[model samples]
Target: LSLSGFINIYLQKTFVSKQLSNLLINGVQPPPLPSKKKVVVDFSSPNIAKEMHVGHLRSTIIGDSMCRLFEFLGYEVLRLNHVGDWGTQFGMLIAHLQDMFPDYLTVSPPIGDLQAFYKFQKIYDCLDIKLIERGESYYQDQMVEVVKEFEKKGLVELDEGRKVVFPPGQPIPLTVVKSDGGYTYDTSDLAAIRQRIFEEKADIIIYVTDSGQSTHFQVVFAAVQLIGWYDPKVIRVEHAGFGVVLGEDK
Candidate 1:
């Protein structure tokens, strides 16, 4: 046979080898990691007292799948439900709740419809208020403190009465604090990351969200890395972004 013919025969044999079939059928599971590495799969972080929308469903499904995969792979998977239990929105919610029920602290109010109650306590609020939550109150001060410390290091700066970080080569600067001096999503995320790394000892941290927030996560990740909180060598951080789940045009 010609050289080319012989090469073709060899390739065919290699592809259809009995060993290959066995490997494929048996599924060669990779050996476990050297040590039980701590991994935090931060996903499905829906805020408390809010209706879970399609977005929340997406995160929950995908995050659960990842957790299963990691667990099977022999890593110490921490299925972190990074619940959105913090921020200015919660402040508004509490204040409104207090106005509605002054004894809310001492007495547990009967909530008939969460969505309705959350949407319009007395007057109709924003349209998006239907899925509001009240979870991150404790992190309020912590987030502010974290941003202020970053500001002292020259990483975060005040643009217009708001503390922010304009990352190198990035267009939109991450707003840690707003003009009202209220802590934003950026500040809470930083505080969470700091705690995850230092306290939780998360060697590998992953955030699963839709592609829309890609820039937001990127900016926050960069900010933390710049401030020396995240060192690539010691720990790994990634944003597992997915595309949108659009409805078909009927």
Candidate 2:
């Protein structure tokens, strides 16, 4: 057979125009993933009482992009906005509010009007991004259980009156409970990760934050692995970190 004969046979078998029309209409199909996995992406974590800055914007956009990609790839994606709505700072704010407004219980406080003024949800709405707000306060009640579990597994130790856990090969110890019997970021993160794995049934968990928090998430993931919560080989955990956005002056 000659080149002309091979070309004639190929043209007869394949419909070139039809294939092009299909490509244009339906677009390209991406390869199937290994399995239908659930992905939980935590991002756009702006703190309470603070304005949303460039860092939060970057994280939100990046995380939403990843969620869209995963959804396109046939994965169940859960977009989470882990806001900083708990801590000692809130206690101080509450105390100040109470002091300023003595009859706060009987009458509506003036500050109540501003509650919706600086909400991060407004920004999400403007961007047309969907996210569930599960802040640190959501895991406040569960922190005690996390500490109990850590104590049960002998993963926690009393270091200078603070309950801390030292991940394997880590130089710094994670302070889960402070000396004042208050839960820290480590405790809430541990609780959140466990909830995402056990309750939410997430096969992959991705946290989008600034690069400065890379070590924090690393330590949290390591501690979770040490607790035997989830097998690293089975579940995928990642921290998608971005660089800091500096001001013009800096």
Candidate 3:
């Protein structure tokens, strides 16, 4: 399209959008002008043992900007880094430590390059099926120990075979243990959500992600609703999704 045509189309679209906004606002019973609102945001949660990539960088920058915007608007903003600090990655890491270098697992940060250690462990396991099984077994045992520790403190419970419990309808679940007696990401996330809400008193949970993740967020919110953690009529989950940041192909 020519420059004049593009400019004309842009103006027309902008005018239409403004008109739609005006119509909607005028048609609805508007809430009182903005007051104190609690906003919680989840971002930059990369999985354990995974390299942080461009996507994570985008989440960090965007989430920080959003939190700043809300803070400037006078809302109580809680920035949450839902770190992938639990589950299966630890399975492999712990297994390799126990099997190969049994002495170093207990050593403080004084001795080994932990990152390099995990890297080598991954390489070794990839080349050995027996090591894979051992890793799986170790993961299961570690999950049990973690669950037991939480259960002792009355923080976690095992249900059915492995389901754990959170408040019903709140998008949380009872992730006791997996069918393989392993701890799943869903289970660990359940713990994290519970801690964030009950311990931290988060009033809202906002997830910022690519628009493609909307379904994932929707299902999670539905689970929370079904599990009884949220009241659809009052509290809710919002996805601040954006389109892909595109550039010309190489």
Candidate 4:
């Protein structure tokens, strides 16, 4: 045989040997699977009044695929679209809309033009100073009442200007109220988490948000622990970490 022919034959023999070894191992029993149970797979829930951009599209695609896979594997899947429906941003969106049409934000569509609404809110926030002031005031008043009640009960406190929630060192004091007395992210998140657990009865609450927000999620999960919502062993809260997409390099 030619030199090249001999080399090819030798390579093929080595490949076959490796394949046989792999096949023999494959005959062993696979590891036991986890106990069958229902699962809640949350993903792609864009803020209610925000645009469904390319990133959101990717979330929907991946989340739905996961839902399907879990369903096929005999897990009862509950799909959650935890929309960002409430916040300071909404105050502007609602206020600017109230100024423009006087009746814009009345209709809370189940799933409607969120991206456009967010865009409109941004435009109003930038162009109109008076409207921004009004928006900030609106959200502030709403937060004060809740924080005062919590403070009176001694469930929360102000530390270093911001509302710090000291829940036995599991997590930092939650900032339900900001330094300016505005409702921070924690309040809305806690309300949403409570609703999901009690109303939706979510077995697994997976937050499919940006990885940079992992610390925020850890704090939220710790707060959940403080609130005594679920047994840490049974109920699962996870931040499904993922990276941002970048342009392909040549």
lDDT (Cα atoms) of all candidates against the true structure: 0.73, 0.87, 0.58, 0.63
Model 3, span 106-147: residue lDDT tens: 664343454644353343254331111112222333445546
* Poorly placed runs, candidate 3 (over 4 Å): 1-33, 105-176, 194-199, 211-213, 242-250
Pull out the clashing pairs in model 4: 47-84, 48-84, 51-115, 165-173, 165-174
TM-score between model 1 and native: 0.74
Q: For candidate 4, write residues 72-191 as lDDT tens digits.
A: 766767776555556666787778666766544686444344454555335324533111112222334444554564566677866777887766665456788778765667765666
lDDT of 3 at 139: 38
**Candidate 3: minimum summed lDDT over ten consecutive residues — where?**
129-138
By summed lDDT, the worst window of 10 consecutive residues in model 2 runs over: 4-13
State, as a TM-score between 0 and 1, how close model 4 is to the true structure.
Answer: 0.60
**Could you tell which candidate, 2 or 3, scores higher by lDDT?**
2
RMSD (Cα, Å) of model 4:
11.6
Error of 4 at 50 (Å): 3.4
lDDT of 1 by residue, 139-228 (tens): 666776787678788886768688778878776888887898677777778888887888889999999888888998888888888888
